[model samples]
Target chain A: DVKVTQSSRYLVKRTGEKVFLECVQDMDHENMFWYRQDPGLGLRLIYFSYDVKMKEKGDIPEGYSVSREKKERFSLILESASTNQTSMYLCASSFASGSTDTQYFGPGTRLTVL
Target chain B: AQTVTQSQPEMSVQEAETVTLSCTYDTSENNYYLFWYKQPPSRQMILVIRQEAYKQQNATENRFSVNFQKAAKSFSLKISDSQLGDTAMYFCAFMKHYITGTASKLTFGTGTRLQVTL
Candidate 1:
């Protein structure tokens, strides 16, 4: 079974503070993603990494960035946390394209910005 | 951009009953994958079932199944013999094929909240 784990299940930060959310996968999948889930808005992608040091902006990438220094780890960084950034963040991992593979998600981290 | 829509916001069914969750998507691509994901109170996303757009037959996983209407671009999930454990926020997603060594991104629906009562 593919297991994806997030670093923190809950986090609180003040406005303008930088925050980091970490995600790791045991399956060595090549693709990792970060998404912020909101009611009525659905899960919107923030960022995604296809390989080490390679990253792409998803639909909603403002005020957020990602890091993939290694194959097993992906990190999401909030450049300047704001109250609007408070939402449930989810991490997911999957095999590279052409496999008809599904993304395996981690237990989400509910971040609160004060 | 591909879009997924779950028109129903909430649904309820009694134990041993069946319920269906509706999903619709709009995309220009002909080849892709559709999925139903369940996120319980634990907030862990679990894959319930999947259907390929090219396949004419519907996909099923035990008590979970999908009615895939290709031409209409509608995919709905059906859960049979609902249990307490079946209560969750169910999301429908779509994935387009990416290039070699690249990642395929999934666009998810707004989610339907399912409640199973006695």
Candidate 2:
């Protein structure tokens, strides 16, 4: 079984603070992704990394960035945390090959910005 | 761009019964993939079932199955003998086939929240 673990399950930060959400996968998958999930809007992609040091912006990448220094770890960074950034964040990883590969997800981190 | 739609916001069913969740997607790509994901209260989202656009046969996993219609671009999930553990938010996602280097991003629908009752 594939295991994806996040650094924090819940976090609270003040406005204008910097926040980091970390994700690690044990399956050695080459593709990792960061997504923000909000009520009635579902999950929207924030950023994704295909390989080490290679990152791509997804649908909603504003005010957020990602780091993939190693294959197992992917980190999401918020330049300046705002109240609007409070939401559940999810990390997923999958094989680099075909679309049929399943993207295993980590238990999400619910961030609260006050 | 692809868009997935799940019109049902909330649904309820009794335990040991069957329930179906509807999903529709708009996309021009002929070859793509569709998925149903279940997120429990624990917040760990897991894949329920998947269907390939080119395949005529619907995909099934244990008690979970999908009704895929290519022409209408509809994909719905049917769960038989629903249990209390089946209560969760179900999301329908669409992914277009891409080249090797590009990572496929999923376009998800606003999920349907299912509640199982006695």
Candidate 3:
């Protein structure tokens, strides 16, 4: 089974604080993605890494950055957290463009910025 | 940019009943993949079913199936004999098919909240 685990299931932070969300996958997938889920907008991609040290900005990349130092781990960083940044963050992993086209998602982290 | 639209915001059905959720996408690419993802309360999201655009036959997984219309750029999910466990947020997603190593990003609909009541 492909297991994608997030560091925290819930988080609380103050405004202007730096936050980090970690994700790890056991399937050795080459693609890792970070997405934020909002009520009306659904899940919007923040960033994705295709390989180690290679990252690409998704539709909503502002105020966020990602790190992929290794194949199994991907990290999402919030430079300056704001109240509007409070949303459910989800991590996903998938095999590099192959027969397996589906992405396995981690239990999301709901962050609250006060 | 590809856009996926799920016009239904919420839906309810009794147990043992059937429900179909609608999804429409705007894209120019002919070769791509469409997916239905289910996210239950407090649990991680999971792929319910996926249909490749090039494949004429609809993809089915047990009680879950999809109606894919390539020309119309529409894809919908139908759950037969809906159960309580089927209650969740259903999101329709699109991803361009690629043979290379880099996987394409998935564009998702706003999601339809489904409730399977007694």
> For each candidate, what's the DockQ?
0.75, 0.80, 0.74
How would you encode candidate 3's per-residue C-alpha lDDT over B1-118 as one tens digit per residue? 8999999999999999999999999998988999999999888899999998889999999999999999999999999999999999999999987767566789999999999999
lDDT of 2 by residue, B1-118 (tens): 8999999999999999999999999999998889999999876899999888889999999999999999999999999999999999999999987668779888999999999999
Candidate 2 vs candidate 3: which has greater DockQ?
2
Model 3 docking grade: medium
**iRMS (Å) per candidate:** 1.6, 1.2, 1.5
Task: Give me the displacement of residue A73 in model 1, in angstroms.
Answer: 0.5
Candidate 1: list runs displaced more than 4 Å.
none
Checking candidate 1 for backbone clashes, the offending pairs are: none
TM-score of candidate 2 to 2 decimals: 0.98
Off by over 4 Å in 3: B99-101
Worst 10 residues of 1 chain B by lDDT: B95-104
lDDT of 2 by residue, A1-114 (tens): 999999999999999998999999999899999999999999999999999999999999999999999999999999999999999999999998785567899999999999
Error of 2 at B82 (Å): 0.8
- Which run of 10 residues does model 3 chain B get worst, by summed lDDT? B96-105
Candidate 3, A66: how far from true, in Å?
1.0
Docking quality tier of candidate 1?
Answer: medium
Comparing 1 with 3 on DockQ, the higher-scoring candidate is 1
| Candidate 2 chain B: 10-residue stretch with minimal lDDT | B96-105
